[model samples]
Target chain A: MDTILFLFSLFVLALFLGVELITKVPPTLHTPLMAGANAISGITIVGAILAAGADTSSTLVHALGFIAVTMATLNVVGGYLVTNRMLAMFKRKS
Target chain B: MNITIVNLAYLLAAVLFILGIKGLTRPKTAVRGNMLSATGMLIAVVVTLLDRSILTYDFIVAGLVVGGVIGAVMALKVKMTAMPQMVALLNGSGGGASLGLAAASYLQSLERADFGTGAIAVLAVFFVAVTVIIGAVTLTGSLVAFAKLQEIIPGKPLGFAGMRYLNGVLFLASLAGLAMLIANPGNTPLFWLTVAVAAVLGLTLVLPIGGADMPVVIALLNSYSGIAAAAAGFIMGNTVLIIAGSLVGTSGLILTKIMCVAMNRSLTNVLFGVMGEVG
Candidate 1:
């Protein structure tokens, strides 16, 4: 219950913070911003690792956990690398 | 070993993630922002491993290696023009992970006979159902978005007669399934059925959206994946997952709104206007 309440507060705060953070960004940077945000969503990789590593006797859990870990890792690695690539192009030539 | 220390580390990781996003507001710091967030992820992963003793590390290691290789290759080889589709694909994989995690949790609960009786059980079942529905929808919707963006499918609204009505009906049925699952948390059949229906609903929802709407759709799906992860966090009682999920969810929503503004469309219109058609 306390956790849920805390999480709700966090959600509201993050929403406002996100809006504040991105409002100043130029339209041209939106693509890279979107890409960067996609990488952030890969935070689920943490949850996936927990799932895969959870102590359990069920083979089904193990299988699902393995698959989740793989997919989430892909999201994390691919998302960050791709965002970096896009940002590289966006950087002004020195 | 120490739960308190583990949680404290998670808190630190969450703070780093926030700083990472803050850094992204400027172009100069964006790359560093990405690295900071990745470091946060690394910290979270390592801390989780330290907190738990696994029966086997084989699957986890194998998954990391395989997924890492594929992701690196895709990131390196994909063209800038194709970045949108690649992002969509990555978003879909996140959704896929959520779906798998939610299912695994449900299975674990069943195995352990942990479906406590009464209101608590109902809440547990509700969270699991929400995770599965959103996760499944995100997975398929993202794939459809990718297909449209990639030209694998026509980049136009694809709808038939009564399509909207069919979608409404399926959505209602899924809601009814949720009600049933809550009433009886042990109903595995109902749970799977709801998942199947939700997957179909996801496909139907995105199929009618055109290529021009891919960015918004992808952003929206990214938010769905985050919400799904948050629900999974509730099921697992993990504070970091909750914080990270909310961050992603809120950020994705903001991005979707930005996309809508850039396109000069409202969220409702982007979702329901069925581009390339009059209505």
Candidate 2:
């Protein structure tokens, strides 16, 4: 319970910090930043990889983990590449 | 690697992630910002692999290769006009990944009978159930949003005569499923049933929303995905996941709020207003 509380505290603090940081973004870059931020959401891939490789897990767990990894990879890889693409367009225009 | 070292690496990665987001305040550094975040992700993944708990790599290697290739192809091929659609798709996959992880984690805990005692055990079950619900909702909601944006479905509001009542019922069912899972303690929990209900709920909830409101919907789902990941982090007791997930969670919320302002609608209206009739 203490651990949960600690983690929860971290979650809340990070959330506030995120709001503070993101508000600084100008409206012009909203879409690109949104894409970039979505890519960061792919951080779930960490959980997916851990689940996929757990020694005590069953075949079902492994299978689910496999799919999770694939999905998360798409989020990270597809997300970042496309975000970069969008940002590049902005750069070219400026 | 030592536990301390692994955790330290995770901390460094989290710092990089924060820096990455901070960089987005200006366009001059935005692209580099994304690269920094990606680099942080690479560090996290590589370090996670070195943890001694994993015994084999076949599934990991195969999944990375396949997912990586497909992701690259889609990213490269998609037109800029289709960027929003691509973002929606990728965001959905992130949610799907969280759902899968939560399910797997729940099952693994059951197999090991590792649910601890007292507040910890109760909290564990709570987090797991919430993670599944939120994750499933994000995945399907984003998909429906994607379909609408891509013109795979009509972009206009599409709701049945009794959608409100049905949505109410489904929402209640989701709550009931959650309550049952938390109350039962053990033995064949209704995980899949809960998943199905939430899935349908996502489909129904987003269908009534018009295409013009998609930015709000996508932003909201992106927030959901991040929260799901954070809840999953609770299940695993991983601090890094918790931090990163919450960062995305709130970041997405800000984006949603900004979109709402741009559309001149309150969040509630965007979420549950009377379709084209509301605005």
Candidate 3:
């Protein structure tokens, strides 16, 4: 199969799956869910790492890559930690 | 070190990401889900570094350490009341990363004379252009949304005469720039011009959105960043990126829809109404 065509199919499947996954989440959890999803968006860190480390010869590319890596790491680390903090408050009393 | 092994690792990471989102559906599993997703990210980063034989580990290590510390401190210290703003800023950072990656890729390609004049090259340029525009827009737009939510900028709708008309013009200009980019992939000047216009478009589009609509705006921008990353993945032929990006895009869109519904406003109204101030 063509790679792009396969990617589009995967994209459509993920779309439906995403809606199905979150449809039942209550409003009270919306903030934490959003935070959690924000953390997931930090998946760009993968791309950033590749870009930053792919070529060390070009200073400009290196700078861009380094910045990307730093910003993405911040997103991933901060996002997860904050989501965990928020979810901690939602726990039921023992 | 084998290519197939790296691909398999990426595939595994993608599955972990999906499971992470699924876990978030329930409060009891939300924290675990977050961890699952973070683990997935770690796996992906490590695999990319080892598989690609990246020559510069020092910069990457420095970025991770500094960024991790800052993120941890912010997460630990931020108030719940500021959670929305924090999410907005995090989303912005992801968008910033996408923009940075796209820019780096473009510059590197230019240096290597990789932008060959072929159908495939045009298609690759199209994806890169999409990445640049969407990534830039998401970065600035999310920042504006963050400022509004943070109350650093006024939360009231800031409209000027014929703002909608101006936005329309800017949107059309970006499309024109995109067409130019596809026609000639080596046109770096045109590419940066398009990105700059898109950045302004993002600012104008979000400036008039009031504070009440910030949550929806943030969610929508989150989707934008995901779509931008997906475009970057297309350019790089990275399957895991495409999968993870689409997952975030779809989930963010769903969340935006839910927020709109919760606010009793349609998506169109939230975006175009610009009348969110309630006495």
When summed lDDT is taken over every stretch of 10 residues in candidate 2 chain B, the lowest stretch is B270-279
Candidate with the larger TM-score of 1 and 2:
2
lDDT of 2 by residue, B110-206 (tens): 8988888877877888888888888888899899989988999988888876786787888789888888877764735487888889888888888
Shift of residue B44 alpha carbon in model 1, Å: 1.1
- By DockQ: ranked, best first: 2, 3, 1
Stretches of candidate 1 exceeding 4 Å from the true structure: A1-16, A92-94, B272-279
Candidate 1 has which clashing residue pairs, if any? Answer: none
After TM-score superposition, the amount by which residue B251's alpha carbon in candidate 2 deviates from its true location, in angstroms, is: 1.4
| Alpha-carbon RMSD, each predicted model | 2.2, 1.8, 2.0
What's the alpha carbon RMSD for model 2? Answer: 1.8
Question: What TM-score would each prediction reach against the true structure?
Answer: 0.93, 0.95, 0.94
Ranking by lDDT: 2, 3, 1
Number of the top lDDT candidate: 2
What are the Cα lDDT values of the candidates?
0.81, 0.84, 0.83
Better of 2 and 3 by DockQ: 2
Mind sharing the TM-score for model 1? Answer: 0.93
Clashing pairs in 2: none
